[model samples]
Target: MYRLKPGIKQNPQRRWELPDRIFFGHGACHILAGTYLEIAPLKGFHAERIIPGDGFAGNHIFVTDGEIAFDFHGYSLRNKLLLHHTSGWARVSDPGWYCRIEDVDFNLLDTRALNARKMLGPDQYFGDPRIRARSFLERIDHIDSVKKLARNVD
Candidate 1:
């Protein structure tokens, strides 16, 4: 059976207030999504990198499998995830949301996600966002099939 995990707690009241690590919702979507793209496959899950589709401008990125999306806020339905975007930046349903990154295309998205690592500046407690993501996964009870991924990864 597939298990759904509650979304990761985001700093909704105070952005960037979490001093110990780069807060996932605070311009760190790329980092979180990029981490999943790299790690999920190794654990036998398929993850696709995505960005907002045409006519919408967004600074966020996430991973999905055409149904659930994994981002700084953990796993959630793709549309449900967008509803939580109350920051008044992007309108809901604008540009029809999510566009997939083709495998053949030059991935400026991944490059940006990778480049985001250096921009954390003083918030980089764990040295890298991917490391922080792993730490987050280890402590949380996410999907059922991959519950052991963190402990099992070498």
Candidate 2:
């Protein structure tokens, strides 16, 4: 059986703001999302909606096959083992001055789910959240869109 592990506890009143850092000439989180989405499938993994905060809800996520756990590279964040936008070396905490998402594990944050309405409604955006998430997946799949929406807050 799959489990709905506790994710982040965010204030729904606040909208997600873009990460202040410009990573690889684009928004840090966007680049993180895009790049990770680009690589996940090659390893037989798919993208899942997640909540971002100090750390991800779980070290594992439920997939159709089963549950998969985080693949931290011997060292994760000291900050509550916070999930990197992408996991592995040169990850969210270690994107360096500029880098790519290759050779990295996917984010532990991706293990957590974001309540669609609660997360998006405050921004006055009303639509199926899956649409946007899947769209981003498709974009990354085609290598056309490197932009991922950072729509939820922690």
Candidate 3:
């Protein structure tokens, strides 16, 4: 549930042949974070899309408001998010462990997120991440949390 590999362990591409739900916190992370970035403003919160530098694991996308990060696992301290993606290495193994956020680069709203089919290529493994993200938010009852975060920010 933490590392980048399918479910925190190495898996063949054939494993990814499953549904997007199977890869929720794994491969479909970009879509989840991108969905948050797209919806934050509408909910009255300001967030920036973040793409960790090469120092970290594989490609990962998340949103930050300078304090908290919103990703596939939901909200977390912006600083701690990197630790969750050490690519199976120890938390301290990553060169950016201490300053991962500082080394991160900003990304614009991902166009691929707009169409689930465009995310991972022609497979369309994920039907529509936006819908999935919304479902996750609702299922977790995070509407109030989102409102609280929004209210606390400028």
Candidate 4:
């Protein structure tokens, strides 16, 4: 079964909804296929990052934003994602062929965020570490969400 992965579709009608102020945080989960669920920087998505042997748990994604006050690579991130949108760490079920935001407990997009530049930024394979360490981890940086998110991956 081929489910649609979220991205900026050429057709506006096809755009997925996202909650307001959702910084994809960092990192992405890889599904059975070669595709990945990385932060849609909107520009720097590299196929090279998602390797067959690479697990989504430890892979680092360069996330940047001024408001994020949590760990960029751990449990804190999962909370933030759940609290804001795409609840329960999205993943594919019912055969587990791909990862998708299924039966979300919360709404996915802010009315404004979907149409704004928020999702149009460039996706980086690796961003500035100094900024990432400081910016992505302001409030809850110690907790790791890899395990929390892994459960969702079937």
Highest TM-score: give the candidate number.
3
Candidate 2 lDDT over residue span 1-154, tens digit each: 1221233123221212311121111212223333334445334444333333333222222221112312111112222222343343224242332322122234422222222212222123223223343444444332211112112111
Best by lDDT: 3
How would you encode candidate 1's per-residue C-alpha lDDT over 3-113 as one tens digit per residue?
112342233324334532346655555556556556564243343433545665444565666555566656666566655542233444454455434322223225444
lDDT of each: 0.48, 0.27, 0.51, 0.27
How would you encode candidate 3's per-residue C-alpha lDDT over 53-140 as one tens digit per residue?
A: 5464454556666666666666666667766654434443655532233322333234544344223421354255457666665555
Which is superior by lDDT, 2 or 3?
3
Per candidate, the number of residue pairs that clash is 0, 0, 0, 17
TM-score of every model versus the real structure: 0.50, 0.23, 0.52, 0.19
Query: For model 3, what is the error of residue 51's alpha carbon versus the real structure, in angstroms, after optimal superposition?
Result: 6.1
Q: What is the lDDT of residue 1 in candidate 4?
A: 15
Q: 79-145, model 4: which lDDT tens digit per residue?
A: 3533332222223222222223222121122223312512222222133223333333343323244
Clashes of 4: 17
**Relative to the unseen true structure, what is the Cα RMSD of model 1?**
9.5
Which segments of candidate 4 are over 4 A away from where they belong? 1-8, 12-18, 21-91, 96-154
Lowest lDDT block of 10, candidate 1: 1-10
Q: TM-score for model 3? A: 0.52
Ranking by TM-score: 3, 1, 2, 4
- The candidate, 3 or 4, that scores higher on lDDT is 3
lDDT of 2 at 53: 35
